[model samples]
Target: MNKSLIEKPAGCSSSILSRCRAAMLIGVSAILGSSSSDAAMNVGQNLDGITYYSSGSVFANSFKACGAWLTSPVAGGAWDTGFGDKGPSTDAAFVMRTDGYPTVVPFTAGGVSQYVHTLAPVYENGTHRLYFTGKGTVKYSGPGVAATTRVLTGGTVTFDVTVTGTNDLAAYNATGPSLRKGPSSWYIDILVSNSTDPVRDIRIMRPGYNTSGRDTFDSDFKTKLGFYHTFRVMDWLRTNNSPYTKFANTNGKDGTGIGKDFYSQGTGRGVSVDHICDLANETAKNIWICVPHAFTNAGMNDMAASFASKIGVGRKVHVEYSNEVWNGMFQQATWVAANVSGANTPQKYGTKAAEVFTAFKTKFDAAGKGSQLNRTLAGQAANSWILDNSLITAGSLTDSIAIAPYFGKVFTSLPSPLPTMDQLATDTYTIMPSVRSWLDSHKTLALSKGKVLLCYEGGQHYVGTGGSENNEALTDLLVDFNRDWRMKNLYRYTYMGDVNSRGVQLFTAFTLSSQWGKWGSWGSMEWLKQPIGPNSYEAGKEWGIRDWKTNNP
Candidate 1:
């Protein structure tokens, strides 16, 4: 839902409900429509399942234990350490520290002085060779450096490194590599013949890394069986802010262009479709893919065919046109608003979504896998009219209507001296009735149209907007609120409790793990390494959802 539509009233009691009602009314007035019948409420519907919305893939991201990168190094540039003024470096190279580094170094002389391109290999400890194709010199610095240098002669070159215990970046940086921790600044420099473009097809051939062709995912990632039911790859594919119109090549070179190497810079085009399919096949998890809005009919057909052929047997595919086309905050919404022709934004989105669904359905049906596809039409949870208009226009093409039924938007705009943790909890609990009412209306509409109800994203949405996020006091309050034990109760009891009883078939939590800051505390846990369990104070939203699944199952 658009943030501009929600208003923060002075009082906590009325503020939350009024904001929800205001958004609901705005949606109702946007389009004129009515449902003929309401589906009978299922009193105690067993939760179909609970899944996670994954955090995006980036060099600094710590969500996956095996790490997002295979062997490709972090791109060289001025490092944004979130403070200020980190020094410069050569292209395709990384610096360990600006204080100890030299500037204006030649590419032939190892790019930058005292700089070693860092990589996060698998957690397993042993001798492993980091492989890459091209003529280059591999040099290692910091701890775990077994063989310092290996010369490359336009062929695969392997550098050996021995890791001890679990690779924790904080410990590695603080006290070197230990049995329980690894350094974040473990550096390996690869100076290739081509200065502009470094090495190609870099592979970290470690024990838990992609050493075997069968199991490519990290050991820690694969061990989390609860999160494997479905993996939404919106962030993995870099769907937002993407400009891809065609499929990424599986064998393309790194740094050439968009959609090339799977390990290209995080800001570049997304990973290949082959990698996404491989992840699903290896993990045996259903994949929810968001088609890029810029894709043409041919591109859509190609993507569908690729998934139909490559996706493992019996694993389902949840297909959404794009991530929130109705929310004007994203580029896709803006693109549709300008490019797509319709009576309104919902109709235009519906028209394009129908076309996308048709393309995927045709290919999947042709491949004899139509039953494995879940065609989802997403809309704002607060707005029934968006779904009403879109679903009506989409007709039989959509199999499910998806929405994000999050609570706590009232806190986003609340002024300084924000509500206390107890007050926020009260407001959260008070708003449950309204959220349930909204769900009841949408569930009925979905059933009336013969479509299932699914949640693409949902959880505590207590982030500030405009310049409110910059308020240090507000940021501190929100962070503390997330860490508080009461927040867990609200998630397990009020939020998930409501959705489960309301008969939402699938409720995917907003995200897996992320660092909490001014932007938003979207992650269930602060990071993958954070302690998680019923007794652990560090456990927050992740524990709540996990505990719910255990009891419900």
Candidate 2:
């Protein structure tokens, strides 16, 4: 008994019937074609002689069709953080039939699901293309009677940039650079020596009463601390011949340039964000810029979209959503990590931290916009044990990890009333094992998804206490350690910590000698000078003994 498959639609034209039979013989693999008004379709005839037609459309709704996914519930319906007006902000998706019938759908502004009815079919090159409209779509193969086995490999793919040449190494060891060994790394004694010219100044004197909480704007210090100084340091680095490991404002969850009162109020945490962009434009150089903030709420997507539009999509700018949401201290410090400092914040991390994370991922993966996201997750640890599995394992979400640990002594010259350097090294070493253990556990859980780890911001504290000898030893250890691991990216604590001399009891001798006198000095008074660590002058720019030897006292 030989086998002969047949397909017959009652009352159909002979030509249609003939085409149907041929299609059946070709099996379920669609040989879909379009002839202007007449669309040709292929159907597989089963043992019962019943045939099925491929019907559907492809649309650009879901971020190239890789938007939100249906997993658990949140708030009400499937937790949908909803992307900005521009669909999925990250990845892309498509479906295909072995017979050449194709349908492709992309995300629409971070939607949980796209509109289905409006999908369109694309016909070209003897092939008919189908795509999803709004809602997420699934691809199924085989005869319609009983579809068997789930096909899991039919989506876009991307790869990380492999570090090549000595460029990365050279940059890693540039002047005043920080170092890392395995998981533990910190800033060292590198110096940025400026010409004998006055360091820089912004003198504002108001004759009227100071309604903003102080009399003389001079005495009321603000510039002596925070990322403002960080910006200055970065600015100086750019002008100099240093390699650029860029920095930017990523805190956009709530509003613009890190909310209004970020340092105190939960507003504008990443105020210096604009500074990064401005710096890039002014220099016209392609440097690694990062937005330090969490994308917990929809705010990240909006900010990302805005920045992408300005910077042009798929450029060198890197935007990290939420700085460190995994840390236990998220409520108070979430903005610091996420970088969302704007007016009338869209949402907060009440019970929505995980939801925000999920939404952030969905948006990032929905559109091909992921190319614009060099998302990083930053965290602080007292020791190596701080980087356990729980910190990173979150599906295919995170891109990079920035570990900020004040491992060495509190200050380079003074000793803290705390633990010793040996203990510090021991604790720092423990972090690598903990990170490894955590990564191993999460790798198993996620099958090794997400970005490999990197330390973004970790430094030896130099504010209050810590033995000078310990600081020196730690510095040497960091140099040796960084050489060993060849850490990806490293940023020290900060540029200026001379704010301690503001009030009476707390004084510091460290002030940038200015033309009009120390800009940070008060009322023409030379305050009790407390020498900050070796690099405190220009924040490690001139700290290298090479420069010191050449310059002398």
Candidate 3:
């Protein structure tokens, strides 16, 4: 826990140096709203003390709502917004826009029906200013929040806000037809104290008849909100999402997609994301870094140590190689099989993953974090081949074998006339047995070999057609059902210790923060803008607050 353990990597490449520059510019923009639109003029002036932020780059494309899906659309295609030569500009403004609308489930149906935008919260002009756009006049009710102007139709709206610890929010669009259709989105940021420090709470509140954006704010609303419970245990690196480059040009998605780009690792979006500043501002989080296969050692270490210093050495960290190595949809998957010498068979992908793991481990260990780390191994979860094959060396080469046992994939492939939420729940629970079997066999095998089992990514791999007008009602049902069932019990705890399976110990919810519409519906619960409620991902982290506090304290 000493400061000595907080190591900052030296000798970053020229590219990383540029990235640091981009990151620096973003920090400044976060405090002083970008001079792009009227939202900045009004909102920035009204809410003088609050800061605003989008998940990643606002220009990044939205993950495309309700269309070709799995059959015709590409695999892992939806995952990558834009990367490589086709990425975003590092000089892009800090914005929060998505490609398509990840339609919302009506609030009346127990789903959040809106999008949540984020601002980092800054104080100027005697008060911090916050701004966002809504469908109609909506009244926001929460802790220490007062809207300067909440009227008219879709344009920049401003609010004067203050926060202590975690805050709760709800919007009432009286002029709009109904809560579900009227309220568009609410932008919120949390502050632990009056100090000028930034708050990283960016959960979106969607319009809905049955929406409730509640969270298990375990951390004192006065202290480092939610840090003890959620932030401490989380792997923030987002492995595959990290984009290390040659010219600090995050070339990452900087925002064109619209409402889809939740986290930036793809086309560097808004303010050209450099998560280092993100970590420094919200220091409670532990990163889940996935070192891009092509990144330079200096660049990778720079990111690793920067994260270590912010998170501190006392915290446990996960060093994963690439994102999803087995999935052929991603570039990494294709590159691994085609390029890595003998990395031909699907089994060999794990071997490649191990290589990346080893490489990063050497860097972290050199940085004096040997005892505070876990070298995670990635593998295909649904398949039995990866259950106990080349992916592991019993007790060596890996600390945990990552698996993906999603419950909703079964429902996604069906054509139209989708089953109701009740049916979805029924069918999902029915599949639990087989899922438990698969997890049990693999989990048992891994534990026997002295390696821990983790869900590298797990969630409802299905995104309903709710984003479409025709399936809107059905979407509401699905969202409601997911919220009532899948969101909490199933994803975070339900199968935690099933009858037969040893149970997945630590699994990343397929993903963490995602834009509204399909990706926001299921699997990843890190954060949801629209259908986001108190029991959203925030509650998931809160589930272990008491235990975490007791153990760590």
Q: Backbone clashes in each candidate structure, one number apiece?
A: 3, 81, 84
User: Residue 352 in candidate 1 has what lDDT?
Assistant: 86
Clashing pairs in 1: 168-182, 172-182, 172-183
Q: What is the C-alpha lDDT profile of model 1 across 333-401, one tens digit per residue?
A: 889889888888988889889988999999999989999999999887766788898976686899999
Among the numbered candidates, top TM-score falls to 1
Q: Estimate each model's TM-score.
A: 0.72, 0.30, 0.52
Candidate 2 regions with alpha-carbon error over 4 angstroms:
1-254, 257-275, 281-296, 325-330, 333-369, 380-393, 410-450, 462-553
**Error of model 2, residue 175, in angstroms:** 31
RMSD (Å) per prediction: 9.7, 33.0, 18.3
Residue range 1-553, candidate 2, lDDT tens digits: 1111111111111110011100001001011110111211110000000011101001111111111122211223533233221112212321211111112223233344331111111111111112211212233111111222221222321111111121111122333324211111110110111222211110111112212221112221222221111112111111111111122224222233332212111112222233334433433422233333333344544544444444433434433333333443333343433543322122222222334345444554565555654443333332222233333332234554433322222222443444443343333332343433432332233223444443233222212212332354444443333222111111111111101111111111111211011000110111111121233222232122112212221
Off by over 4 Å in 1: 1-128, 138-150, 162-190, 194-198, 205-215, 248-261, 265-267, 409-416, 428-434
Instruction: Assess each prediction's global lDDT (C-alpha) against the native.
Output: 0.54, 0.24, 0.35
Q: Of the pair 1 and 2, which is ahead by TM-score?
A: 1
The lowest-lDDT stretch of 10 consecutive residues in candidate 1 is 42-51
What TM-score does model 2 achieve against the real structure? 0.30
lDDT of 3 by residue, 315-397 (tens): 56666666555554455666667766552445565565555566556756777877767777765554556536555332366
Comparing 1 and 3 on lDDT, the stronger one: 1
Runs off by more than 4 Å, candidate 3: 1-285, 305-311, 343-348, 387-395, 409-418, 428-433, 459-462, 465-470, 485-493, 499-503, 510-516, 523-553
